[model samples]
Target: MERTILMADGQSFYASIEKAAHPECRGKPVAVGDPTRRSGIILAACPVAKERGVTTAERVGEALAKCPDLVVIRPRMQTYISVSLLITEIFESFTDQVEPYSIDEQFLDVTGSLALFGSAERIARLIQTRVQLSTGVCARVGIGPNKILAKMATDNFAKREPGGISELSRANIEEKLWPLPVHRMFMVAGRMTAHFARMGLHTIGDIARLELGEFKRRMRARMGRQSDIQAEYYWQTANGIDPSPVVSGMRSQIKIINHGRALKWQTYRTFADIEPLMLELLIEVCRRARRYGYMGRVVAVAAAETDGQRSSGFGRQMTLPRPTYLEHELSSVVRSLFLTHWKGLPLTHLHITLTDLSRDECYQLDLFEDRSRLIRREKTVDAIKERFGATAVIRASSLAPTAQAFERAVQIGGHFA
Candidate 1:
């Protein structure tokens, strides 16, 4: 039996929430922005604002210039999170097999619910009405036989269609989906579009029709020897051949754990000023790694300079002699990478990542260090934080003027709590 999947997305999620909260702003031009130094950009713009030439990710100053009457609201991340959770509950009412694609979008396998709900379209309409009535945010839904087609239909057709619902299937893909420009397809962005154009593959139909072997060969010629996997992925997407199930509580395996922070302003320039921030970030990364019961063999560090116009940065990674989830071990590698690659520039961002992970069930015993004591100490810290809070026990460096971990603990997604 063909699976019925629906991808439901909130229309202008953040702005819609603000409008719903402030009823006076309904049907007016509205945008939600982060009023912080690091990101004074518009996070979401309502349809009314978009019509007035406002766009998300543009600076608030630019958005204001485009629409002088725009109602700019600061982001309330916690409220938005609450709303997202509420929406999840609403989706759960329909089917047990609902997966959140993002805060604003969800994929639901209603194949099992059709008998009770009538039809997928009917269920989508009911969901849309309930979401609007409950949250004052409109919803658009895409229906398909699989997840990929449902997602593409939502982005390409459903959001634009009058009914705010559209469906695509293998049977009707050639007529309805294949004629569009290759870039309009899901996962085909500007860079991929340029590559496809050079290969004379200008439409989804073009790639969909190609034999798998030929497609991989052409992709190899352009993207080099390691392009087979990516080439096959795009081919399967274009043909709408997703065999993946819409699993409830679905989680992709965690391959890497990282911690990063952007400064409120670019003031720290010297090595002395930046080292403390790096230490704080590295500690958090290590803590998370230990919490996940994983030890990583590779450590990567990145520091970026945020000038007003353009961004310049350096990222470097080094392999460890032995896999470990201890900050003391990773700190040496992070320090070497930062000092070796970073030029003497004003830095505003710091990031550290742990990869090449393996189960931390055992570790190679070291001759110099008390491995047993370190492991016990780390576990004690993790337990303390888990029971109390993340900030219940933190390193002294996090109290320094340059450190962000202390302040960040109170915030969500780098915004005010």
Candidate 2:
């Protein structure tokens, strides 16, 4: 039996959520972002805002200039997360096989539920209606035989359709999807589109018409060795021949654990000024490794200058004497890396990564140090935080004026909660 897959996405997710919450903003232009911050850009904009020349990722001031009466709402990350989860529940009610492609988009495999429901189109409509009625946020759905086509159908067709539902299949793909510009296809952004055009492939049909071997040969010539896999991926996507399954409760294996943050406008020039934040990041990274039941033999630290130049940053890694998920061990190496590499340039970004991991089962003891006692203390701290909140039992250094842990606790993605 052919699988029935749907890619459902919330229309203008953040902006729509803000509009739904504030009844007065209905039918007016709305954008979600904070204008005062250095990174203040329109995160999401409603259809009304888009029609008025407002675009996502544009400066808030630019959006305001476009739509004079634009209602700018600060993003409530936690609230958006709650609504996303609610939409997931609504989707789960219709089918057990649902995979979240992103916070605003999800894929549903309803092949098994066709008898319980009526048709793929009907199920798409039902899911759309359910999400809208429950959350007051409009949903657009694209139905297909597989995930790639479903997502493409959503991005290209469903979003433009009045009914906000469209279907694409291998049989009708050439008629409906092929004539569209190559950039209109998923993963074919501006640069790729230009490259495709240079190769005399201006439309989806152009790529699809190429023999697989010829396409791979051309891609390899331009992209160099080992480009065959990526070349084939694009070819498959163009032909709507995805074979990947919609996995429920999907989790990717953790090969490395890392955490990093970009400073909005604050640039630390002194080692003393940067130490607290770096320590906090190292502690957090170690906590994550411990929680994942993994220990690493390598630790990496990165510092990027505030100038935004690609060459301004330094990233260095060091192999540990042994694998351990303890904060002290990681912090010792990270601090050394920062002190050695940071050239007194004003730093706007900091990062810590743990890699070369193995199962965190046991550790070799040292003759000088009581390893078991330190391990027990770390485990206890993890236990307390798990029982309470992440910020419940923070290090005393977090209380320092320079520390970002307390501030970061309430924010998501560097924006206010």
Residue-level lDDT of model 1, residues 1-417, one tens digit each, is 799999999999999999999999978999999644334889999999999999989998888877889888889999988898788779888998889889899999999999999999999999999999999889999999999999999999999998999999888999999999999899999999999999999999999999999999999999999999999999999899898988775434469999887764365777777888888888888888888888999999988875556668998899999999887888888998998998777787888999998768778989999987998898899899889877888888777787666666777435743
For model 2, the local distance difference test gives 0.87
Itemize residue pairs with steric clashes in candidate 1.
none
Clashes of 2: 0
**lDDT winner among the candidates?**
1
Among all windows of ten consecutive residues in candidate 2, which has the lowest summed lDDT?
408-417
Local distance difference test, per candidate? 0.88, 0.87
Model 2 over residues 307-384: C-alpha lDDT tens digits? 444337899999988998888877888998888887777788898999998767667889999987998899899899
**What are the runs in model 1 whose C-alpha is more than 4 Å off?**
35-39, 250-417
After superposing candidate 2, which stretches have Cα over 4 Å from the reference?
35-39, 251-417
